[model samples]
Target chain A: MILAATPGTATLLVELGVILVGLALLGRVAARFGLPSIPLYLVAGLVVGEGGVVELVTARTFIESGAQIGVILLLLLLGLEYTGEELTDALRDHAPAGGVDLALNFTPGLLLGLVLGWDVRAALLLGGITYISSSGIIAKLLADLGNTGNRETPVVLAILVAEDLFMALYLPLMAGLLIGGDALDIGLEVTAAIVAVVTALGLAVRYGDRISQVVFVRSDENLILSLLGLALLVAGIAEHLQASAAVGAFLVGIALNGPAEHAARTVLSPLRDLFAAMFFAFFGLQINPTDLPPVLAIAVALALVTAATKLATGWWSARQVGIDPPGRLRAGATLIARGEFSIVIAGIAVAEGIEDDIGPLAAAYVLILAVGGPLIARAVEPLTRRFSQLGRPARPRRTPTARGTTVS
Target chain B: MTEINETKLPGVGTLHDFESQSGGRIGVIAHHADRREVVIYDSADPDRVSEGVTLTAEEARTLADLLGGTSVTKRLDDLRQEISGLAIDWLPISSNSPYVGKTIGETELRTRTGVSVVALVRGDQPLPAPGPDDELRAGDTAVVVGTAEGIDAATELLTARAR
Candidate 1:
């Protein structure tokens, strides 16, 4: 009767229902296709977004908020997977090689940005995107290969840790730069953010177990609510403080310990997955399909150069540890993927109204490597192995286990 | 057991990890005398926990049964042999177990195996020192105390097909 006269909640509900159902079906298809569902989700976003098939007039606002949650949860889950203690120790141990890694892998993007005649900030953003590798894809490759006992894994891990540690330090700095303050203001903001993060980290390291004891309760509902609520609260505060909500959520995740950590992860993973999908879609939604064709050539060429540089970074780092040539090759191949962090950097930059080209370029570059990374990693083993065999028989090395890196 | 690393958490417990056949680390927290928690690390990120499963002493036995393969598992018997003298073990009664729907007294578990039911665990709740008059439900864990021989007998009796 009056449904036609006024905009009702039913329209929003129906749209959301349709979108969610579509996402589920796409997720299943992606699983079957052995893709990460990220690409599929991105495509879905592009199709549903502006200048595409269907424009959702009602659900756009809902999606925008969901995307923010997605980014926060993505970083939070990642942080929960890694702890503060891990980061500090990794940074301390791998500083020199990590330095080499930064110099080599990061140079391509910076040089490319300069060549393309972008401003310093955008160039830096581009460089940041190029420097970081995708831990998510590499991790999956490691698991799929079931070659966990390989000699090169620890070396690869050291490099990954170094990258992760760098991101933790670099993200707050980037966020401050995005705020467009003068030198002193930027420095002060960055310092405050770093100090806050470090203090929070120190507290987590010292009082994590005790915090867990307090957070856990007899009821599952209370446990999840408290953990999610705390993460959101930290993220909000971090955003207000200009520390980046991702960092805040991540810190909250790393801070949780013991029984609460396990329970919280179990409860929060579904929500994280949901939001993470939305985040990817939102990223895709921002990119105009028309802009993609022009960026395609640069994206492919940049991916190739970065892929080579990443290989060089891995080769040099693993070589520093005296790994065999084949192991070095494997290490190089494994580090090729660039997924979450690159997109995140671009997202933050775009949010600050940086060059529009940055987003489409990043989205294109990530799409290339996230798909190609796995294929290359899979092929590298046999490729390197057979090549090594052609030269001479090699003995399996019994290397000492990596120190301070007990997976447990 | 070779210790990969040890951390002493003052009020909580001592955490010990071991290097598995794979490069990943597995850890156990020996908490409050008898309680233990098993931890598995994320292979890709050694700093974070991939999984942490906290099982009570009662639930752990049910886990033992599951990991033991089938009910009449050779490994479970070998596990009992490790505990000399008076031994305690948890035996699971599946949905279709012969002893289901009968009182502990009627099942004559003690009569057959010379083992006493120390407790009965149903889900998270453990009924300590379960009386013989208590009914044995499906998916119940019978916590029996006995010698290795008695446990083997109980294991056989619990898993046998219905009469």
Candidate 2:
């Protein structure tokens, strides 16, 4: 039956369906191997994108839009995860650690970018990509490895909180700087952005209960719709103000509190998972498969150096909190993975057309780290145990609770 | 009651830990996703957890019930011995309770059921010797003092929906 083709609709549906199924398969593969699914998604994009086995023309626009939403949802969820109290506490106790983390981890990427002759703005973007560890991957890793309850785990989490809060300020400033114009225009845009973000954050912290009450609806569907609508509207407004849409969405997330925040996460996580997949794939699609190989050496070098820096950051922070060497190692190893946010940064750079090689290099760099990070985390404990015997006698196992330490 | 240290774990959830009678440090992590993890700290290194067991939401509830049920009964027994014939009861205010959002004076609890709400526990704050004008909110635990029959009647009257 030679029925008329339904213009672009049929092809779009087929392409979308095939892509989703492929992603699901890749997700399962990732789960089976105990690795984060991000690398797999990126690899899928590389293969199906330009200069690969297949090209997606009809679905390109859809994926691009989904990618944008994906970035918004990722930041939004991150904001929802922590309270203002947690952020303040993390900042109070771990400001020094945060500084160290920034200096050690961000320097590698920025230095690499400068060495490669990229402009300062593009180099800053690269610095951001390398600085932030993947909270999603680290959280999952902690839970998977039964390290969530470990003493050093909290140290890692606090550092992540510090990084996340920093992003709220950093994103807008970078976005403003990259918005090419005279210094005054850039300064005005950045100031407006910071003011907006700070005001929103203040409102969220002080009056979140009232805000949550206003947003709360009886039905989950209505609640989610309202949340999604608010996020998009705020993001659009922020984008108009030259403050990144993702940061706007993040502020909206912070504003929501109490039961509404909890319910919102339940309903929104699936949608986030769906859209975030598209975002990673879309990042891969922008990089021609051929571009990846040319950047592989640089990516590998960056990954190795950054991994060590992350380890040092974690080790130093954990030691400050009195955690043992092994625990510190665990913290460092877990912090090595850089996934969604790195891609988000790179995606922004690519859109700005700051550097042609930025997309491919970022994709390759993230891929190596994302895959290698968890493996190294898992290996660290055993490796430490093995190596420690050479330096000192093996520790004797102590009786459970023998210290007579009173309850605090 | 044992003193417990509560730590807020940024993105994870709350961690409540206490040293046991046996001198072992133990903690429970209540995850945002409703999962719970019971962990025992390493004796050699207090910073590390030597053992950890994850529990589903239902499993955690069950464990709490198993541990708490006996203490609840034992406390009631101690209360009974201290005041013979008179009884003290704690009644939770569920969201659907008729008394919710009403003041104690509005409930006319003492006049109707001969039971006095001696205290109200809202969240972590304990309002001792609540006045008649004190409001009754959902999720409050009212500590009522009366005879057994009167307390039972007050519990029913307070919990039942209005026609």
Best by the DockQ measure = 2
Candidate 2 scores a C-alpha RMSD against the true structure in Å of 9.0
Over B3-90, each residue of candidate 2 has an lDDT whose tens digit, in order, gives 8888788888989899999778999999877899999986655666778998999999899898885786556434432278788888
lDDT of 1 by residue, A249-324 (tens): 8777777766777677778889988888888777777777778889999999999999988888888877776766
Instruction: Give lDDT per model, in order.
Output: 0.76, 0.88
Regions of model 2 farther than 4 Å from truth:
A1-5, A385-408, B1-3, B21-23, B69-163
For all predictions in the order shown, the interface RMSD in Å is: 11.1, 2.6
Candidate 1: which stretches are off by over 4 Å?
A1-8, A394-408, B1-163
Count clashes in each candidate, considering only residues at least 3 apart in sequence or on different chains. 0, 1
Tell me the TM-score of each prediction against the true structure.
0.69, 0.82
**Model 1 CA lDDT for position A408:** 50
Q: Please write out the lDDT profile of model 1 over residues B1-163, one tens digit for every residue.
A: 3446665432234567777876768776655334566777544434334466666877767776776737545434344434559888878888778889899999787888899998998988999988879998998888888977988898888878777
Return the top candidate by TM-score.
2
lDDT of 2 by residue, A1-408 (tens): 447678778999899999999999999999999999999999999888999789999999999999999999998898889877788888999999999999999999999899999999989999999999999999999888878888888889999998888889999999899987998999998999999988988988888788889998989889888989989999999889888899999888888878988988988899999999999999888889998888999999999999999999999999998877877888899899999889988998999998998899899999999999999999986765554455455456655674778545
Tell me chain A's TM-score in each of the predictions.
0.90, 0.94
